[model samples]
Target: MDLPRHHTIRESSHRILDPFTDAQLATLGRALHLTPGTTLLDLACGKGELLCTWARDHGTVGTGVDLSTVFVAAARERAASLGVEVTFVQGDASGYVAESAVDIASCVGATWIGGGVVGTLDLLGRSLRPGGIALVGEPFWRTDPPEAALAIGDFVTLPALVEQTRDAGWDLVEMVLADEASWDRYVAAQWLNVRRFLDENPDDELAPALRHELSTAPLEYVTHQRPYLGWGVFALVRRP
Candidate 1:
């Protein structure tokens, strides 16, 4: 989807859209060696949850850039509310450059930077200093990706994702699989926001379509796919 619609949908349901869990966040924090002074660049940072949380807990300095102006605004608001000084910019994360090299560069759940994992790492590397960590949050099919799986949205298998990263000069530092409970939380939380949106704007043009999509999504997700799909965080570091 384009920026306008994508931002609208995400903004409408950012609260419901649980992007990560406690374990996943802890894993990333540990992998990045998050500290008061550690700096990270979050590419394609959707609403800047990862960066904002890290900044608040770890006292780290970070920035998140996304193409969605609405998300950028929300992220900025989140940072301010948390009293963290994270800079959220509305820009193209695919090519956004930092003023200085960073210690950790991540593109969680957004591999559009390099068109895939390999390319995303290459992009992260360009912005990292020596010995920096590159974290990628991705979804991996729990089993082999069937031909019919192509009907599903943007995702690749675990093996293929690992292969691509290794081939791109990275070593897996850590990995944490998101349990089914986490997935349930992530999906279920969004329904609240969708419901709220529908309640507030009953006459909205897209409300019907959004409601239909959400109503059927869980069934399609659990029955048709959840049994065979996995979500995880992969933290990799550039080799010296």
Candidate 2:
């Protein structure tokens, strides 16, 4: 599916699709040393949860860019709801030129920008001020990817993922791993969203497609991802 529609679906299921939980956000905040006056940029920010939170909690100024107009509207509404001043732009994150350099930049769970992790960091680096950090949330294969599995989607092993980041001039500053419970929570949430969509749009053609996707997702995830992928978040800093 194209990115816009994919992101629309993700925005519809964000909390569930997200690998990070509330507890994990706390951990990440501590890891980033989030503070007042920090300028952050969230590339592919879905609904601007983190961006708005950072602005409110840390007094951070931020910008969030996403391709989905639906998500952009949601993000803006969230920012207003929180009474936090943050810019949420509707645009392709890969092509989004920063209005100003940021002290921290992030691409949580959307690494397609730089062709993968390494490239994403490089792109983030270019948008960062000196001594800035790049926080990337990525899924790693717990074991080596099977030939068939690798072909199924964008995936990489843990060691390989780490090696590439290190080679790309970033030092891994912090990390958080997802447990089985987290995985189940994240994936299962999708079914609820799809079900809601079906109830509201009974005659919509995409409903069946979404239903089929949700029905098969758990099995595919258990078979292909559970045994192979190790999901985690990493905060990387450009070496000063």
Candidate 3:
């Protein structure tokens, strides 16, 4: 629907499509000690960067599901280009069920697919083999939230976020946090994407809205998101 369409447009120029730099993502894969033949399922796997890169770097096999048709196509193309054996599917990732239990079940940066972080962990758990890992990317508060930050919804400070993860029945094994620069890198690129689109399709119905976002988003991010919000991909394992 509109969400997928908007995402495709907003992130057209992205490869990883999250706040993570390529180095950080590679750090995660290495920290996990990824082995050849590891099987992974990624839900809401935008552009399938995580899966595709892991497949190439660690010899992992993966399936990635996303709602954006163009993203899915791009993912497939990326896999082919990398000579990695990974599958990409276009569909509603919220209800995706992997064909089989996988060594890793991940829903990074798109936990809304299962409502929120805990629910997403549960969803990923459903497709994880025993002893498998569940990877979730989520936002946490870095400092005391201002009144404006409260509107960001349900995000707690880092310690509480970790506690919440533990309460959700997983042990947080490893994490990779995004800094202010990373946030800027992820969002500033969207401004360029929107500008390019609007320049080419000035008459498009979405143009005005995008123009509004382009005008307002940078300030909003600098004022609120950059200082207060921290995002990270967390590696989880079932609690004993």
> How high is each candidate's TM-score?
0.89, 0.90, 0.96
lDDT for every model? Answer: 0.77, 0.79, 0.90
lDDT of 1 at 9: 60
Error of 1 at 173 (Å): 1.0
lDDT of 2 by residue, 1-240 (tens): 125363465348673236777777767777788889899898888788888877888898989888777778888988999999999887889966576889989898888876888888888888898888898888887877677567556776788888888888889888888877777777777667777887888787687788788778778877776677677878888886
Using lDDT as the measure, what is the rank order of every candidate, best first?
3, 2, 1
**Pairs that clash in candidate 3:** none
**TM-score of candidate 2 versus the correct structure, residues matched by position:** 0.90
TM-score of 3: 0.96
Report clash pairs, candidate 1.
16-190
Sorted on TM-score, best first, the list reads: 3, 2, 1
Report how far off residue 28 is in candidate 3 (Å).
Answer: 0.4
Task: List model 1 lDDT by residue over 1-240, tens digit each.
Answer: 227662356356553134468666867687666789899998988788888888888888888888877778778888888889998878788887778999988888778667878888889888888888888777778776566565776666788878878877789988877777877777666666677777878888888787897788778777756676787778888776
Clashing pairs in 2: none
The per-residue C-alpha lDDT of model 2 at residue 136 equals 85
